[model samples]
Target chain A: MTLSPEQIIKLGDLAKLAVTEQEASTLAVQVDDVLKYIGRVNELETADSIGQWKDTVVNTNVWRADEVRAINEAERNELLASFPSREDDFAKTAPVFKR
Target chain B: MRANLTIEEVQNGLRAKEFSAVELTQWYQRQIKEKNPHLNAYLTLNEEALATASLVDKKISAGAKIGPLSGIPMAIKDVIVTQGIRTTAGSKILENYIPPYDATVVDKIKKQAGIILGKVNCDEFAMGSSNENSAFGPTRNSIAPDRVPGGSSGGSAVAVAADLCTYSLGTDTGGSVRQPAAFCGVVGLKPTYGRCSRYGLIAMASSFDQPGVLAKTVKDAAIVLESIAGPDRLDSSAKDKPLKKWAAEIDQDVRGMRVALPKQFLEEGLNTEVEKSVRLAAEKLTRAGAKVELVDWPLLEMALAIYYIIMPAEVSANLARFDGIRYGMTVGAEDLWSHYQQTRGQLLGPEVKRRILTGTYVLSAGYYDAYYKKADLAKKRMRQLFAQQWQKYQAVLSPTTPTTAFKIGEKTTDPMAMYLSDVYTVVANIIGAPGISVPGGTDSQKLPIGWQLMSAPWREDQMLRLAAVLEKE
Candidate 1:
């Protein structure tokens, strides 16, 4: 499972990473090792095991009542204070979406 | 055994008024001050530890009955969330990130009146086996300072072995807790998957990450495990199965219990000293009246490979939450997308970034079946080995690692070599069985080795029983 340098960079880009050409070159070798390492998973024979896919018997989730509540103003302030940009009672930042 | 006293002794001392919690906390704090400069074991030290201990002492004086773990001071792995404390997960991005709420295990331990000794170092997002990937710095092995501490729970094990604390909480994702304990000559447990809640734990490889404990003695490990185990609603994956009576069953004999040594794990790559120590432990068990057998688990060979695939794929998913949008470290940029890339690129360590990239490639649309699904199927096969063995043998045994701790930089440049450090320990996580690393003996270098004991799913009591018997011998 060899990957081209361009393919590796594409994956990194899609993953929201800023990889240098040098780092990409190193990753090509490391990723190849990872691919080769995980290939050993193909050696197992798990034809008869079904319980591995069914962990639902372990625990069941129950519903809880929803209630409007106040956020801890002090804690929220502390959180906002750590941000590099802030305004008013919220963290200030660029718009999340652009058209 | 001043450095290896059990939790029971510490509790008894506090109950008898022999020493106040404040005194005990100070003792541990001083020990950390003296030892940690060399080991790099701790990420933060709680300034309020003694004050908290004073409160516990006042409660004890007033005859207010406390939990079994009351007044015991311990460190927490940086990966677990600690409200109002910096929980970095050994990443530069989260170096100043203080979680707003305690993780479920933290809440439980705090309820038992345990004193917080602050957070210990670990691999970034629990990505690496050795502590070299920590953004803070690598944790040196307590036994041999020149060697690496098995990680990403290396700091917790070092703290326990060096007597910096009574016990520490560690998160084991693919043997982060157990392997380090093995290397540091302490006890570590990776409880049955879902035995401990994962809520508020900075997520990393969600399916395999288990919050476990490290302690100087097997009994102390059980005491901590008891406090944190049991189902919790906060973590949806937590199991509803009854918590094992670990402390209660510690004294039970392992006589007549069928134990098997998986030949597949014992042969070839294992170090000669580790093999000798494990076999000697097996002989001790046999002398204690248990039947020891050699068993074959060929599928165990695929565990490390499957783990690397499933773990990083999940790492990519779990760490995706840190994209500088809502919380933690954020680097400002002209656009939201740039904000994410710039923030993560600056904040994450090299190993973490490498894993995220590998995970994305593996989980990409076209490659998911060939990589992720096949790894899942391999995990299924590993589980079958457990099912077959548990029906005959009560537990499986092997050396925890191929050797004792290696030199700090021995394999740092080679990620594959570092990944193989967890080769023996990863199988249990993949199979979702309970596994423990019991300190067996040391190599000629005086570095400690460990013998791993694994049992069927939800059978921690039996595993602990076997471990206790080994401890006695």
Candidate 2:
């Protein structure tokens, strides 16, 4: 159940986070501890029928009218203004691809 | 004199002209200024609170009819967005983010003329058990300054306990509202999932997260629930049922009702005083003609393990939205990937990062079936087990937390120790049941211990009625 430093770094990368070497080492141990605890879930006997039972307990695929509603212009502007970088009513971001 | 009034009493006072709304708001504002430095309960006070109160006062003077919550001042947890206010969700990432629209519950409160006091501090993104996880600072327990206020809704609990506001709004994913209320000596209610709209709550574990109420009394919590609970087009999960009158049902007798006390919760790791107080509270219920029976529910023991896996998995998916391009913190970098890495890595706190990492690991390619899928099936089994219990028992009773509030920094270093504090409360969230924590009694240090009562889905009326019996005792 223990995680290696490389695994921790890989997880951070997958999660879109950057982990320092120190953090990776610390998180390696902590994540291992948490995973060890969560390993108890393996002891529980789960059946294939449980998936069908889950659907009975939960409601899904709720549908609403497919009608267009105008967005509040003021609210939309406010949301746009909240972006860290904005350009002409759109959120700006760092270049996705660099040559 | 105004500081100690309950929500009902506040309404009565307003109707009787005992105090104007503006005067009441001023009292709370003054109290916050005086007490908040030590408590760290409030992160940001609403600058327009006085103006809103004045408007309520004018309406009253003009003979206009006021809503049920008219002029009652209350604070909201930082996780719930408040328009025009800096809603940080107790994270450095959202330090400067101001929401443009109100959360559905906030809008409902405003329409009822509930005066907004401020946004209270919480654990970052409502992730931690203790308020210690807050990036700002830990909120001190109102009774004992050195002891930590149980969290992630610690500030909301403290505000109500200290009479800084009539009531406060908080969110409970696991034990955020109820655990803190147990520590701070107030009433906290986590309604059935989808009872209140989640339209503006900063998402935590989306499946478990629900808006909750922390108030001075059970009736006050019920009143707030009645005010905010209903169908909303904004939150698809919100139940489309006719709203029940929760406050009106508070006085209903619980005579002859059957309640189950799960034996598992009363076993190991439980504080002796907390156990004794909860048992005494059960005795009181029995004396009042309710049948209190001890039941063995071993499936309950697996709740915390299941929660850690499933909750983090959901947290990973929900928090993936916090990239640099959107509303939160941003760091300029040469590439988009580095922008995300630098912003989140630099801005999110340690506990949050841990959760994200664990979440990603479980949902990762190799471990998905072993961890995430198994946890989901376990959750389903747990739900069915609870349903069977509900058929026999009217409600379940347990200690809200394993122990009373631990001293500050006591359990901060040990994440597992902090996670164990929620063992008793997480079941309610996993099963999507409504639960409440009532101030049962106090320990040797006079720290409050709460007795928790939970009922089947959408049965908040029954849950609150049982809580009312405890409140009367």
DockQ of each: 0.46, 0.74
Q: Candidate 1, which segments miss by more than 4 Å at Cα?
A: A44-68, A82-84, A95-99
Worst 10 residues of 1 chain B by lDDT: B377-386
Clash pairs detected, candidate 2: none
Q: Identify the leading candidate in terms of lDDT.
A: 2
> Candidate 1 residues A1-99, lDDT tens each?
577777777887798877777877888888888788887765554444355553422434566677666778887677676665677767676677754
What is the C-alpha local distance difference test score of each model?
0.84, 0.91
Q: In model 2, which runs have C-alpha deviations exceeding 4 angstroms?
A: A47-59, A65-67
lDDT tens per residue, model 2, B58-141:
999898999889899999999999999999999999999899889999999998788999999999999998899999999999
Residue A35, model 2: Cα distance from true site in angstroms: 0.7
Instruction: Please provide, for model 1 over B1-473, each residue's C-alpha lDDT reduced to its tens digit, 9 standing for 90 to 100.
Output: 25555789989989999889998888888888888898899989887788789989999999999888889988999999888888888987887787778899989878877899889999888877779899899998877889888899988888888888888989888999899999999899999998989997888888898998998778888888888988887776787888766897898888889998989888777898898998998998899889999876677788888999999999888888887655677777877777777888778888988789888978899988778878877676567657866899989888999989999889877888888889999988988888999999789989999989989989999999889887775
